[model samples]
Target chain A: MNAISSFTASLPGACAQGLIWGIMALGVFLTFRVLNTSDLTVDGSIATGGAACIMLIRSGVPAWTAALAAACCGMLAGLVTGLLHTRCRIPAILSGILTQLALYSVNLRIMGSKANQPVSVDKYSLMLSQRYVRAAGLSNPIPLLVMIISALIGLAYYFFGTEIGCAVRATGNNRVMARAQGIDTDRATILGLIVANGLVAFSGALLSQYQGFADVNMGRGAIVIGLAAVIIGEVVFGKLLALNFALRMSSVVFGAIVYYIVLQLVLALGLNTNDLKLISAVIVAAFLTLPNMKGGDRDA
Target chain B: MLEMIDVCKTFNPGTVNEKVALDRLSLRLEEGDFVTVIGGNGAGKSTCLNAVAGSFAVDSGKILLGGVDITHMPAHVRAKYLGRVFQDPMMGTAPDMWIEENLALAARRGKKRGLKWSISERERAEYRELLAPLGLGLENRLQTKVGLLSGGQRQALTLVMATLKKPQLLLLDEHTAALDPKTAAVVLELSDRVVQEHSLTTMMVTHNMRDALAHGNRLIMMDEGRVKLDVRGEEKKKLTVRDLLEVFEI
Candidate 1:
């Protein structure tokens, strides 16, 4: 009964975390799989979203409203990085570093008094099902219920089908060709960053509210988690190379679910919380090597 | 309606390995010009196209297209006025994208307000009509991934894509050079059909002297990054392989 109860307790938050991280997982999919470049702004921007949302909600903004604001802020951060890379001609990895560095100060400002927000849940985050429960005057597991109801999946489907989304996906595959076809690779990069970081920020917004507090370190190790979920998704569900946009998206979502399950196992194995980053690093490192190993060698 | 004024480009400008890809090269293309360019390897034929395509910012020069100064433009900005097909068939179209999706992207040239993306009924009708001219039965494969197409088919499709918007200039960077001989001939014929049908001002660069002579209303021979011999009108219409060889001193 204790084991079953403990597992149940962890379910909502873990699942919510997976859904939230699913946003970043899809974002990382753009840089890693789609854009065919690496952008690390996700690490800081995820936190940037949390900090921005926490501060906003504390100022009396609605929960999902704060989340939307955070997503916008995340998009701006990503825009800076995309501009640095595309306009300034800086390499993609270096551009991400520059944006990540600049965001550090911005995130601190968002935390306001140097401490993260601890706004009353008032019924969990606005996105959590508790808000719906409050409206309905009934008992409900807000997180699980809200996850199914949110625009997360539907919005993803819609965005990936747009003309701009087609152009963005093509940019990941080959920027030069996309541009030659007048797809405007620079614009695509900027938009991809905006969408990517927006998703991450949305995740952060939901995460902060669900946990009942927003911490400065909540975004730590987020990239590892996103990548693990993405790679695990590619592994277990097979690759999405030939699949349509919707299937590819659902694949990444599944990847995020499996990744958290694996993460939970690590906790069950008696690993310390501090060692989690190390474990994540090891997992990412292992997955990164899989592509190289499978392909034999393909340079240029 | 295209011109290059004293265009110059030097890679590794200050280094010993520096190469003057274009040196004071000048050329003019009248409206409806279909200039066939031919030269040996490292003769700066591709560089000339690159300069016009905005693939590289020339060290010193002015490229004007349709009376607009585009020399300062980068590749993507100049793409509006220019349609390009690369030597690598894979470089011309997005492989993972469907045929219609790729066509939709091409169709976006010179237009705006792209509301997210909804391929309207009119757009679908337009795409089908556009593919019908290719005659490869590709109109039936609108949803098929471009990656699965043959090199010849892709190249033929690229020809359709480059001319889709009827840009100010079309750059065929040895587009069919990557295909096998039979496939190359088929693509070349398709290129002729599309260019003629659209009446597009086109530039085709090739190493085949026969192809150069066999196609286009105008012919240019480049040497050491400069247009050494340009023949057009009646003279170009009467060009022979031997005459081109004499011009190249081959």
Candidate 2:
């Protein structure tokens, strides 16, 4: 009974973490599913966002402005990966790895060589934080995070419906067709990576603010987490969300919430917190294989 | 409307797999010309169309469309003046997109894409009207995904899309070679109708001899990366499969 109560008590915090990571997962969906490319740059850019946002806040910038700056910084990281893949002809996965390695140094420099930096919830105003997760009224973090995610989804839906957005979709679906129709596919790819990484960085900024600190290693294994949310959402809510683009985006976040809730449940069951990454990897691998295993009757 | 002067393209130069795909190939087409290309395997028939479409950089030579030099232009850049239908129907349209969305992409060819909605209300109506004539019942299924359509339907849709913007030149690279006999004939008939309706300067590559003779206002045979025979107008109409076979044997 005591364990059940404690698990219930921690549920709100887990929910908050899931919502933040849900935004990150949406970014992953854009690259992995929409653009048909697996970009590993998010692992590093996520930390970059947190670092940039926290540092800017420390220098007295407003929270929203700091978050935007962090997103732009993330976009720059994506641009590097895009150029390396499209212009230099480096393979997509390798290009992302190269940028991710370089960003490790860049992130450390952003934090002035510090391994971690903390922002006290008491010292300054924050958009959302753990302290507010359980608080009453407007101070509760759930409403704010929900609103942010909704707004982001709306923006993404609108952008992708536009002429340029269709072109990008075509580029992903059929590169030869896109070129035949006169779309500058290289530009479209760069734009997609930029948008995807920008969203990832924005999520990181919010994550740092929520957790009350920015750590150099905060973004480690972020891609895996984001992918987990995406695949989970698809496996669980895919039928319900497959009708429209907006629903699909919402399902990704829905997947994240489910993931965190389950994580909280397992942790409450006495699983060591340090083994969380291993658990996550196993879960993702299992889910990813489900589709292939079920449809193995036909050979390609 | 199109000219290729001293065009040369070599694959894997100086390597064990080296092959000359286009060797000093030259051809010219008047505006509104509908030319059919026939050749044996590796005769550079498809390579000629690919070169004219700017698929890759030619080793040396000039390609001009409507008297404007396009030799150095990239494929996508040069697409502003060309419409293409590939052998694989899947290569010419995005399968995941809606039929109307695929048409919208083609409609914006040679134009800058911006923040406007991909398919406007007006454009949707226009697409419906354009698709009505294909007799494939596709006009009613504007919201359907292109991937769900059969190979023949996709090719028909692609033919409509290629002429949607009235391209300066239309290149069909064995556009019907992959289909069954009935579907191939349907697509070919549609192709001829579209070319005539728009008077599009067209180049169609085919391995089937009768199709090469039956369609197009002109016919040309290629051998070993060079033009072996060029016949047009009255001469093309009178030539038979036996004559082409004789030339092939020689």
lDDT of 2 at B125: 89
Say which docking band candidate 2 falls in.
Answer: high
lDDT of 2 by residue, A1-300 (tens): 877887999999989999999999998999998889999999999999999999999889999999999999999999999999999999999999999999999999999999898987799788888988898889898999999999999999999899999999898889999999999999999999999999999999999999999998998899998999999888888865345888889999988998898888888888999999998898789878876777766675
For candidate 2, write residues B139-160 as lDDT tens digits: 9999999999999999999989
Docking class of 1: medium
Which candidate number would show the highest TM-score if scored against the true structure? 2
CA displacement after TM-score superposition, residue A91 of candidate 1 (Å): 1.5
All-Cα superposition RMSD per candidate: 3.2, 1.2
Estimated TM-score per prediction?
A: 0.90, 0.98
**lDDT for each residue of candidate 1 in A240-288, tens digit (9 for 90 to 100):** 3665666676677777766666666666655787887888888778876
- What's the lDDT of the predicted structure labeled candidate 2? 0.92
Instruction: Output the TM-score of candidate 1.
Output: 0.90
